[model samples]
Target: MNINSIKIATVTAGYVAGVWVLCSIAVVIAPDTLRYISGAMMHLDLSQWDWEMGMDTFVVGLLAWSFFSWVTVWCIVTLYQYSLRSFS
Candidate 1:
């Protein structure tokens, strides 16, 4: 089967936005948890971790993620189309 790249990109962008919203909410609610996780993952001191969240940050992240996701998905779709032709 074939797929529409634009539609897929829209869906991918929306998924990224949704994930960013959830992550922002999580950070807002339990910033300390995020700080601890970050510190553990990076082997850094929790005191050095700054878990900050705001509307401006969320909007900027959402926009960036949406654009990045759309472009990434578009590239994937293009590669898939190319591969299909190679196989045919």
Candidate 2:
């Protein structure tokens, strides 16, 4: 089945933004849980990461991630469509 590139990119951007927002909230509510989850799954050490959370940072992060996610998914979808066109 063929996929709509823009639709997929939009959905992925929303998903990424949602996840980042949740992570930001988790950072505020229960830092330890966030740290544990990141450590176990992503092998990231939250403590070592130097980041200050604030309104500006949150906005910047959300926009940055959303844009990045959109671009990444758009590229993937474009490549996939191109391959299908070449093969079929």
Candidate 3:
């Protein structure tokens, strides 16, 4: 991709990562909310449920996905630029 395309992709990935991080905060503060939404759509009580493998996993996954996406996009951009400079 060209520099412009890389810039756009990196910016979009960063924005998505920021949003994901923000939403992940809710899981830390209110783990039960995730259970209600994920376990069932009927607002089922999940206080008895384990947060380590369930809600915690979801939160960690989101944060990890966000970070990975942003990093990957940036890496692609760097590689593209390097290839251009090396080949030309």
Candidate 4:
């Protein structure tokens, strides 16, 4: 729609990605790193030797994935909108 809108879109995407990264790191180091805070260290008993992470880690990973997904969607949307405005 406009430069301001594009900027907002990028900022939103960046924020989401940033949060996703933080959460992902949390998941990787979680339960232990997350201990004494957002609940107990409930991962070691679960994901220690697992090929894939346990359910908890998987869920956090999903959240991280969503950020990337949303960023892509928003970027596309913003570009489409901008194109329509400039071309029309």
Residue pairs in collision within model 3: none
Better of 3 and 4 by lDDT: 3
Assess each prediction's global lDDT (C-alpha) against the native. 0.88, 0.89, 0.72, 0.61
lDDT per residue for candidate 1 within 1-88, as digits (tens), equals: 7888889999999999999888888888888887788788999888765755777888998999999999999999989988998999
The alpha-carbon deviation from the true structure for residue 74 of candidate 4, after best TM-score superposition, in angstroms, is: 0.6
Query: After aligning candidate 4 to the native by TM-score, how far in Å is the CA of 7 from where it should be?
Result: 18
**Model 2, range 1-88, lDDT digits (tens) per residue?**
7889999999999999999999898888876776777787976667666447799999999999999999999999999999999999
Residue 82 error, candidate 2, Å: 0.6
lDDT string, candidate 3, 1-88, tens digits: 4586566666767788677666567667887777677668666667688666466776677667766777788777778888998999
Clash totals in order: 0, 0, 0, 1
TM-scores across all candidates?
0.85, 0.82, 0.45, 0.40
Extract clashing residue pairs from model 4. 31-41
Candidate 2 achieves a global lDDT of: 0.89
Candidate 1 — what's its lDDT? 0.88
